[model samples]
Target: MPAMTEPKLISGNSNRPLAQQIARRMSLHRGMSVSLVDARVERFNDQEVFVEVYENVRGEDMFIVQSTSNPANDNLMELLIIADALKRSSASRITAVIPYFGYARQDRRTKARTPISAKLVANMITQAGIDRVLTLDLHATQIQGFFDMPVDNLYAAPVFALDVQHHFKGRLQDVTVVSPDVGGVARARELAKRIGCALAIVDKRREKPGEVAEMTVIGEVTGKTCIIVDDICDTAGTLCKAASVLMDAGATEVHSYITHGVLSAPAVERITKSVMKSLVITDSIQPTEAVKAAPNIRVVPTAPMFAQAILNTWSGTSVSSLFDVDTLTPIYEGLYHRG
Candidate 1:
């Protein structure tokens, strides 16, 4: 058994496989050997939620792994209920490890009479007694401000950069990183810098919500293999559209490295028929059956990154520095070496 402040990992019903993988990573190489503790979260006949922490969590620091993905409302309730249970059980500290933050896209009022649900969700978690938050590749960085507590917004750029480098190993110079929209230029640029590639942008305009978007290439992409980058790939409508424009602009091939794969509705079918060579997404959301059936879609695990973040946070080290190539490369190598 680990000590009281050893940072126990507890998971809700969301993305249990990811939680298990993270547990395995943390337990590697005779380190702390911390594993997940059981926290049974279930519902009643009338759909009322219930949570029970079997382990003695008194004074123990706990991190709850829950991605509010599809069926978002149910998962959100589960997270809140579990946190409430842990708090009442005398847990010293609780960090909500949300890999895919739901309602994050609604950080601001896009239209009149609409709710700022992101802030609402943040407030809900804070009121539930979570001391901190750990989430990956939020749809908006400003969502951190919504949380009054300490929020660590981890990036998938480092992971995607390493994978991109490996994929385009010898032909690195031929790769051009692209942003699917002007909004994502920063995220795309970060990955581009990490990969030592040039950057491009797709200028797009959206007139209304839930409508197909049109974009045009605004940078040199001729005869290059383009990798469009963004934080979320929901529905993949704009993504596939951008890929088509890139190919029309004479890009040899097009791929995307999106952090969240919210393949809602016809996303899988759209991507399957898109001009992109491949659509690489993180397992931030558990891949659905349709997502798995797509031949051109690749799913990458984010568990190792989360594990490192958890360990560093518990040890009072800098979790933000893990995105630096100088820092994360050796760490990832260590993971493979251990394997």
Candidate 2:
């Protein structure tokens, strides 16, 4: 491959710190020179998004790293505008690296008149001329099908599962992996299987947005340390409430491992006072000061993992092995879960 084909990563305001870190990690890991593209993302007096890519990206494989987080609409628009700018600049291939894919929870219609916003967002990106996409821990994995182009839905399971092993001192049997909601059973089941432990589900009923009516513990967790797992913790309502329910169900203690710490208003305060022992989340989205200040909330750097994926993509190698759940399970099973 020609040196000119090397990736040029750029950042948006949503999570520039993480994008910069991923670029540095990639260069260090592969011994290749990598730097973010020189660009300016600004807003006009009327709050309209504007993007300007200073460097010539003609024929370069461009990757724009942006997390459509907090200011979801604004950040999202910036991504689209930047992709358009890169396309106009003659970028060979444009990949939008969204660490946190917004509107993913609305992938399916619940109410009669509801729209599949996830698919709509997917359409917008493709329409903006994005050649591909790279994102982490989408709220719904099936949303990958929404895109016509290649969509790499990376997982945080390997990171969370390995941390669970270390957190429990390699004693897998004593741990119980839990799903905070029935919808998350698949995710919890994967982690539980990796640890070779039992699985439990928290039965929660949602009355409306941001409101969980009731929660019940579904399986045995009485004598074990329960780790509640989920994808995104926007309001943390589900996590905090489920932790309380688990503790009340005779569990010794509770902890949580979530992918994106959206940590919207009151999320940090609720998490800090919750019954969970600790809450570990990946730095997919740049954590807020409140998230950093919360004692129980811990942020894990995902730059190393993303760095590996970026290198694999640039080298024309398959990036699937980076976080393949099944491949990682047997290793832990042999190490400590053996009878």
Candidate 3:
């Protein structure tokens, strides 16, 4: 068997800091040092995407780290162009490490003449010569079916669980995991189960996209520390509203652990002004200046987890073990299951 070539990472402009952090974490995992590919991903005069890989990637495994975040189209285009460049350079394998998958919320058609944008985006990635995908906490788990190639959808539960354990410590029994709406009950239940806490759901009636008609708490949260678990925080309208409803339901305070902080306009402002004690999110989407300046919002680094996932993928190891609480290390320990 031929010796496996070291994997080369190529990052688009979407989240260079995260890409660099992942690269550094990977280097620490093993004796062999993994480095980023010398690539220049820039725009032309008319705002068109361009890519150039300076190093020889012939037969080398390549991974592109790019999040389809704020400028979704531009970043997504950069990823495709980079993949095409790598394919032309004879790269043996190309995997897309998309931390935040945009258009994921549009996985299904809600009305007539509506497009399933998530499926369309999956097709675009597959057609770009990419062989596999590694993404964190997709908005809709079913979106994995849209991809023709191998797709690894990792959960942020381990990271969030660890943080919860650390923050809640001796008061773990007083913490209650909450789902902002019915659609997220499963996600909330999993976290609550992992943390050995009571589970609750916010029965929210949304009349429109950004409006909540009514909300009612489904479980006992009186005097409990409520923690809402969600995948993305876009406008934060749902989160802020949920927090208010939870507080009104007699919860002492509310916190949130979201996988992606796609904090669009007024999200930070809403979170800052809301009664929620804190809003914790992963560094899946690059944080803007306002998010950084917000007092109630905190970001957890996904680099360590993503780095381990990438290493496991490269070694043909079981990536799912990373989520097994029993197998996790001290820094990322498993959540306790109280009877």
Candidate 4:
């Protein structure tokens, strides 16, 4: 495969610091040489969105860094407009590097007349002329199938694994990896394998939106340090409930490692009052004010991983090996010891 020329890194209003960190790792500046047209997004009297890009991007390989998180619709619109601008300016190719894809949990219709909002979001991006996408930890892996163009679903396990190691030192045997629900067992199993620990699952049922009732435990969590792992934590209901159940099951301590801390309504409050020792999350979705102020919340930087992935893709190298399980073991051990 022939290496493509280096792509210009563009940024939307979401997580600018993360985008800058990735750019620094790649030894480039954001929007280098090319004119970055800032889209001054506004609302009409009735509250509809309007966008216009102010600069040129002709003949460049474009990578727009945006996270469809929090103010979801606004951020999504920003990404669409940026892509449209690049397409209109004759950019050679456009890639939407959405570290956090919102509305992913709506991938399936649970009722008779519900819409698959995840698919709708995919359609919107596709229609906006994005040639490819790079995102991490979709709520459901099948969501990738919804996209017609090339889509890279990066894993946050490696990132979380490193943090766990650093915080636990060499006592991997005492640690138990946990899945907050049955659907997350595979994810938890993978983390347990990488970290060389036993695995457990929390049997939980969502009584209703934003409410979770923990029913049982699938594996042994007794007298062991438990780390609840999940792709996203929106309301914190499920996570807190699972943590409580693990404690009742005789787990020594409870901690959580979530990919995207959507940390919406009462989430921080719930986490603050839960049995969790700490809530470790990635910088995929910028945390809200409450999340930032929470003492038990710690953020693990993902810039290096994303930077390397972007560079590898641009240089026409295989990224499959980047997901090596062994490489992450030591990193997690180190993080465990530090904590």
Instruction: Give the per-residue Cα lDDT of candidate 3 at 178.
Output: 97
Ten residues in a row with the worst lDDT in model 4?
Answer: 28-37
Q: Pick the candidate with the highest TM-score.
A: 3
Rank order by TM-score, top first? 3, 1, 2, 4
Tens digits of lDDT, candidate 2, 1-339: 635477889889999999988998778866887888898999999999989889999999888899998799999999999999999999999989899999998999988998999999999999999999999988988899999999998888887876777668656677899999888999999888776889999998988989999998999999889988899898898889999888889998899999999888889999998898899999998998888988999887777778777777777787788776554445334333422
lDDT on C-alpha atoms for all candidate structures: 0.88, 0.86, 0.90, 0.82
lDDT of 2 at 200: 96
- lDDT tens digits by residue: candidate 3, 129-196: 99999999999999999998899999988778878877888999999999999999999988998889
**Residue pairs in steric clash, candidate 1?**
none
- The superposed Cα distance between candidate 2 and the true structure at residue 124, in angstroms, equals 0.7
Model 4: CA > 4 A from native = 1-4, 28-55, 325-339
RMSD of each: 2.5, 3.4, 2.5, 3.3
Which 10-residue span in candidate 3 carries the lowest summed lDDT? Answer: 330-339
Q: What is the per-residue lDDT of model 4 for residues 3-102, given as tens digits with 9 covering 90 to 100? A: 4455677888888878877777666423354333354555678766565555566776778889999889889988898788779889888989999999
lDDT of 1 by residue, 130-154 (tens): 9999999988899999988999999
